[model samples]
Target: MIDTERQDWARGWSKLKGFVEREGHARVPYEHKEGAFPLGQWVAEQRRAYGAGQMNGRRAARLEKLGMAWSAADARFQENLAAARVYYQEHWTLCAPRSAGALDKPVGQWLSNLRRPGALDGHPEWEAALEAIDEDWNPSWPAEWQRHYAVVREILAEESILAYVEPGVTVHGMDIGKWLARQRQSEVWAALADGQRERLEAVGVVPHVQALEEPAGAEEPAEPSTAPVSAFDRGVAAPGAVQGPARAL
Candidate 1:
């Protein structure tokens, strides 16, 4: 009976070592099997034993050497966080919708779920890890809106004249010109939050508020009228020389 138990443990450890070498982590899926060996089940049993305080110190230390993660959920979070980091490096933003993915992970949907109210409760470390990649991994405004802002910022970094960016123009697959047109609308400009407006202004994207000429003998200032002015007519000077119309309060 003692010899049989030692052989069983040796077989399971061999299979687990091979699994770790191939996958680079000891996070085998629950139903995974290595040929005829139930490696996944064996790994789960060890975790159960560890939880029950029945696992031996030497055995647990050996498992840890192979990068074993006792808490499966913590292992999953680390994997997803790695994917998020990869996505951020490529796109410079984490405002991906449900359809986005990274490193074979459903990172977009994961981030979307995490952005829900109180979703990170008791998970401050997870929040910190994400913020380290991009501070606005979650924003007060819509994530999609933040995505647009990030892409446009990239375009501006190239010294592109955004005002002249016509409709249908795209940056990073986003229709920034169409988006800018919407932001220039009086109603849309009025609807934007103060912080959003300020960010736009800092980037020389203030709305083109052309003022109508004062009537004959009028004492009051010219009434401001917003128009779909051509880019040339929008006072789109080179960066430091940008002079935009006064925005409505």
Candidate 2:
């Protein structure tokens, strides 16, 4: 049994859809059609035509009601968009780094873990932070961060350990370089060949270890400089060098 309100809404919606289709405009949600029509003016025109006897009162009322429905839908859509913008602004840091396609699966799993009961007890900020990220939007991180993310993602993907790259598990403080270095030295890193290690070090993923040994049969490293060390060099004294009142004694 079709209620009168449902019947009326269907009739009006059909007309609107037909009009949009006939005009060659792609059918889209009411919110997406904001610029497609001047809905208020169209409703006014229908009312004016009805007053002039160009259309009967029933048809005019139906069209007018349809226009109002579209207006309401559009208003709600706009409110949602504004709210999303605020969410992104507040949580951009968290969302941007995990925006890559490779990170999507782990990110989803991470969010699901966070939403579990009592998971966020002591960390209330995480509730808001996780809510701000929309998996559908896939908001991109800054250009610099994106580059770093890509490098780390590639390394993880190649190693078949993408799970380790999940938020908070690794990448704490967003320090991908440090994380990569630590991972490189882990037991898992033994699976990688020398070439892979060298490649990672080349890109600064792993810190370059200064070779302390002289080349085979080559002279020893130069003697430590006698010039006064800058404040920055205080603790990094030269090997075999003495300092302080011990030298005076």
Candidate 3:
């Protein structure tokens, strides 16, 4: 069942967002709040933050300033947040159609998508980093994982997330999720001719390699140990094992 809350929020956002474009404005309801953001203030703030010259630091500072200015009255912020959430969702749909149901995928399924043939065949280093990304960032996605995966793969393989142009890095507007998704897929790696594959693998996405090499003192990967355990064997007279719940006390 679709979550009613999300449905309502999305519907409300669609209505409100119509007034958020370059030449759009929605008047605040008098009863809603007297201190709501005025159109002019909102535009100026957006201009400062979204302008070509703004960096993350400056953009964040501006946002914090705006947040502080609106701190005294939170209704406006809440409204904007709700609207923003919907806006982000819509943008994802357009830019990353594969993430249609990203909020609902099972973690395992999403992880497994990383292993599909030709998906992450190339860029082994990037693939490993993505597979090893902090669990906190692992999406607790749902069945729509495919859609998000498609979006991510596209961005990583084509658009890239780095905003600055450099010899070994691609700069684009794609987000982490999309970029990671690309790492899982075999875009660059899969497309290589056999002769080029080994060379690419040895090179292995220069940016990712540099990142992994940053910890100069990190230990080399240890040889894996092999251990065996059996549920039945462990259940029988194992030291400190429970003895039938202490024989029912």
After superposition on all CA atoms, what RMSD does each candidate show versus the true structure? 10.5, 16.7, 21.5
Arranged by lDDT, best first: 1, 2, 3
Q: Supply candidate 1's per-residue lDDT for 178.
A: 76
Ranking by TM-score: 1, 2, 3
Which digits, one per residue and each the tens of the lDDT, describe model 2 over residues 56-155?
Answer: 5566566554333323333433333333444344434233333322212344234334445686686543344344444323222223433344446455
The total number of steric clashes, by the backbone 3 Å criterion, in model 2 comes to 0
Query: After superposing candidate 1, which stretches have Cα over 4 Å from the reference?
Result: 1-56, 59-69, 217-249
Q: Tell me the TM-score of each prediction against the true structure.
A: 0.62, 0.24, 0.17
**Residue 198 lDDT (model 2):** 55
Candidate 3 lDDT over 15-119, as tens digits, reads 335443422433322123223434334433334434545435554464444332222123332333233334234443212233233334332333445445675
Q: Decide which is better by TM-score, 2 or 3.
A: 2
Candidate 1 lDDT, 20-83, residue by residue in tens = 9997878665446899988877887888778889888999999889888798565467668878
Deviation (Å) of 40 in candidate 1: 20
Off by over 4 Å in 3: 1-105, 131-242, 245-249
**Residue 190 local lDDT, model 2:** 63
